[model samples]
Target: MTMKAKYQSVLDLGESLNIQNGSVTEENGVLKVKGTANTPYEKNILWDKIKEIGGESPSDILANITVADESVYHRHTVKSGETLGKIAKHYYGNAAKYQDIFKANSDILKNPDLIHPDQELIIPNL
Candidate 1:
């Protein structure tokens, strides 16, 4: 199978993620993919898809994925009944880190208990 055909799923994923500056080429049984994901989570999604298709470390694929934003880990749009603790638990796997999220978004969040629907909160890097 050609490299391009072999890594077709990755290319499709890049498209689905709306990757910017995306380029794909295949040479000598190796596929090279380069793109910029809008967020770190989006980049992670690409990597996870690559690993899923290629195994732990696939030598046939060379992916250059980048995040467009570096300051915030994720920009979460708050939903009704969502608290800092819930958001912290979702991102960091620890509800206790709510304070960390609260502190990072102090400019927007006045209290840990007052997040409303549609509010954008910055999930700072830990």
Candidate 2:
């Protein structure tokens, strides 16, 4: 398969993420992908997808993913029945890190135990 076709899923993901200034091109046997992700989390996911398809250090693809926002790891919108622990676990793999999230969002979160849907919380860089 052509390198472009081989990495089509990565391109589709970039599109779904609404990556800015995205471009894709294939030269010879190598695929070139460039884009700006809104957050570090987005950029990391893109790289994860690339590695998943291409292996740890595949030479078949070259991705240049930049993050527009480095101040925070991600901006998470609270969902129903979701707690800070769950969000922390989703992002940091440790539910105990909920305190960190609560601290980062102290301006909006008065209590770590109390959170509502539709609240925008900053998942700070650990």
| Highest TM-score scorer | 2
Error of 2 at 48 (Å): 0.7
State the displacement of the C-alpha of residue 18, model 2, in Å, after optimal TM-score superposition. Answer: 0.9
How close is every model to the real structure, measured as TM-score?
0.81, 0.97
**Winning model by lDDT:** 2
Query: For model 1, how does the per-residue alpha-carbon lDDT over 1-126 read when each residue is reduced to its tens digit?
Result: 888887788888889979999999887888999999988877887888889989999999999988999788888999988888899998888999999989998998787888889988888888
Candidate 1, residue 46: lDDT: 87
User: On residues 1-126, what C-alpha lDDT tens digit does candidate 2 reach at each position?
Assistant: 999888899999999999999999889899999989999999988898999999999899988889999999999999999999999999999999999999999999999999999999999998
Stretches > 4 Å off in candidate 2? none
Angstrom error at residue 11, model 2: 0.9
Any runs in candidate 1 off by more than 4 Å, and if so which? Answer: 1-6
Give candidate 1's TM-score: 0.81
C-alpha lDDT of residue 96 in model 2: 100
